[model samples]
Target: MLLPIIKCGYELCKSENSENLIARAYPQLGKIFQRFAILQFFNDYGEFVLHDVDPNLLTFFRSCLSR
Candidate 1:
Protein backbone atom coordinates (compact mmCIF):
# COMPACT_ATOMS: atom_id res chain seq x y z
CA MET A 1 0.00 0.00 0.00
CA LEU A 2 2.69 2.45 1.01
CA LEU A 3 5.32 1.18 -1.46
CA PRO A 4 3.98 2.94 -4.52
CA ILE A 5 4.04 6.19 -2.68
CA ILE A 6 7.66 5.66 -1.63
CA LYS A 7 8.70 4.71 -5.17
CA CYS A 8 7.05 7.85 -6.44
CA GLY A 9 8.97 9.89 -3.94
CA TYR A 10 12.21 8.19 -4.96
CA GLU A 11 11.54 8.99 -8.58
CA LEU A 12 10.91 12.61 -7.76
CA CYS A 13 14.10 12.82 -5.71
CA LYS A 14 16.08 11.15 -8.48
CA SER A 15 15.17 13.90 -10.92
CA GLU A 16 16.56 16.58 -8.66
CA ASN A 17 20.11 17.48 -7.53
CA SER A 18 19.24 17.42 -3.85
CA GLU A 19 21.44 14.81 -2.20
CA ASN A 20 19.54 15.16 1.05
CA LEU A 21 16.28 14.31 -0.68
CA ILE A 22 17.95 11.42 -2.44
CA ALA A 23 19.44 10.08 0.78
CA ARG A 24 16.05 10.23 2.40
CA ALA A 25 14.56 8.21 -0.40
CA TYR A 26 17.56 5.96 -0.87
CA PRO A 27 16.72 3.51 1.90
CA GLN A 28 13.58 2.51 0.08
CA LEU A 29 15.78 0.63 -2.38
CA GLY A 30 17.05 -1.85 0.22
CA LYS A 31 14.37 -4.47 -0.29
CA ILE A 32 14.69 -4.29 -4.08
CA PHE A 33 18.45 -4.75 -4.19
CA GLN A 34 18.74 -7.32 -1.37
CA ARG A 35 22.52 -6.97 -1.39
CA PHE A 36 24.68 -4.24 -0.01
CA ALA A 37 27.19 -4.43 -2.89
CA ILE A 38 24.53 -4.06 -5.54
CA LEU A 39 22.97 -1.21 -3.59
CA GLN A 40 26.38 0.38 -3.27
CA PHE A 41 26.82 0.25 -7.01
CA PHE A 42 23.68 2.32 -7.53
CA ASN A 43 24.74 4.70 -4.79
CA ASP A 44 28.21 5.21 -6.20
CA TYR A 45 27.98 4.82 -9.98
CA GLY A 46 24.35 4.65 -11.06
CA GLU A 47 23.35 8.12 -9.87
CA PHE A 48 26.59 10.08 -9.61
CA VAL A 49 28.37 8.78 -12.68
CA LEU A 50 27.84 11.05 -15.72
CA HIS A 51 25.28 13.00 -13.73
CA ASP A 52 26.66 16.25 -15.12
CA VAL A 53 26.30 15.11 -18.72
CA ASP A 54 23.34 16.50 -20.60
CA PRO A 55 21.09 13.71 -21.78
CA ASN A 56 20.21 15.45 -25.04
CA LEU A 57 23.83 16.21 -25.76
CA LEU A 58 24.80 12.63 -25.09
CA THR A 59 22.10 11.40 -27.40
CA PHE A 60 23.30 13.77 -30.10
CA PHE A 61 26.86 12.61 -29.63
CA ARG A 62 25.80 8.97 -29.95
CA SER A 63 23.89 9.73 -33.11
CA CYS A 64 26.88 11.54 -34.57
CA LEU A 65 29.07 8.56 -33.80
CA SER A 66 26.61 6.11 -35.35
CA ARG A 67 26.64 8.10 -38.57
Candidate 2:
Protein backbone atom coordinates (compact mmCIF):
# COMPACT_ATOMS: atom_id res chain seq x y z
CA MET A 1 0.00 0.00 0.00
CA LEU A 2 2.66 2.46 1.05
CA LEU A 3 5.00 1.10 -1.57
CA PRO A 4 2.60 1.83 -4.36
CA ILE A 5 2.04 5.40 -3.14
CA ILE A 6 5.75 6.00 -2.77
CA LYS A 7 6.36 4.57 -6.22
CA CYS A 8 3.66 6.75 -7.67
CA GLY A 9 5.04 9.83 -5.94
CA TYR A 10 8.54 9.03 -7.16
CA GLU A 11 7.30 8.49 -10.64
CA LEU A 12 5.35 11.71 -10.55
CA CYS A 13 8.23 13.67 -9.10
CA LYS A 14 10.62 12.20 -11.62
CA SER A 15 8.36 12.41 -14.61
CA GLU A 16 6.99 15.88 -14.01
CA ASN A 17 8.90 19.12 -13.80
CA SER A 18 6.39 20.67 -11.47
CA GLU A 19 7.24 21.66 -7.91
CA ASN A 20 3.81 20.75 -6.57
CA LEU A 21 3.92 17.01 -6.28
CA ILE A 22 2.33 17.18 -2.87
CA ALA A 23 -0.62 19.12 -4.17
CA ARG A 24 -0.96 16.83 -7.13
CA ALA A 25 -0.98 13.62 -5.19
CA TYR A 26 -1.77 14.59 -1.64
CA PRO A 27 -5.30 13.32 -1.81
CA GLN A 28 -4.01 9.97 -2.95
CA LEU A 29 -0.58 9.77 -1.37
CA GLY A 30 -0.57 12.04 1.64
CA LYS A 31 -1.26 9.26 4.12
CA ILE A 32 1.26 7.03 2.41
CA PHE A 33 4.03 9.56 2.77
CA GLN A 34 2.93 10.33 6.30
CA ARG A 35 3.26 6.67 7.20
CA PHE A 36 6.62 6.39 5.50
CA ALA A 37 7.75 9.54 7.24
CA ILE A 38 6.58 8.15 10.56
CA LEU A 39 8.56 4.98 10.07
CA GLN A 40 11.62 6.87 8.95
CA PHE A 41 11.24 9.31 11.79
CA PHE A 42 11.04 6.43 14.25
CA ASN A 43 14.18 4.95 12.75
CA ASP A 44 15.91 8.25 13.33
CA TYR A 45 14.28 9.43 16.57
CA GLY A 46 12.92 6.19 18.09
CA GLU A 47 9.41 7.61 18.19
CA PHE A 48 6.41 8.49 16.07
CA VAL A 49 4.51 11.75 15.87
CA LEU A 50 1.16 10.32 16.83
CA HIS A 51 0.99 9.41 20.51
CA ASP A 52 -2.71 8.85 21.01
CA VAL A 53 -2.71 5.30 19.65
CA ASP A 54 -0.17 2.53 19.88
CA PRO A 55 1.98 2.43 16.79
CA ASN A 56 1.62 -1.33 16.72
CA LEU A 57 -2.08 -1.00 15.98
CA LEU A 58 -1.38 -1.47 12.32
CA THR A 59 0.62 -4.62 12.94
CA PHE A 60 -1.98 -5.95 15.34
CA PHE A 61 -4.77 -5.25 12.90
CA ARG A 62 -2.90 -7.10 10.20
CA SER A 63 -2.20 -10.06 12.43
CA CYS A 64 -5.79 -10.37 13.60
CA LEU A 65 -7.20 -10.31 10.09
CA SER A 66 -5.57 -13.21 8.32
CA ARG A 67 -5.17 -12.96 4.60
- Per-residue lDDT for 1-67 in model 1, tens only? 4468667876788788689988765664653344434434555676666555355345544543355
lDDT of each: 0.57, 0.59
Please provide TM-scores, in order, for all candidate models, with all chains considered together.
Answer: 0.31, 0.36
Error of 1 at 6 (Å): 1.1
Q: What is the Cα-based lDDT of residue 34 in candidate 2?
A: 55
Candidate 2 structure lDDT:
0.59
Considering every candidate listed, which one attains the maximal TM-score? 2
Q: Give per-residue CA lDDT, model 2, range 1-67, as digits (tens).
A: 5577568777878789676865776564654455556555666665544453355447434543344
Q: In model 2, what is the error at residue 45, expressed in angstroms?
A: 1.4
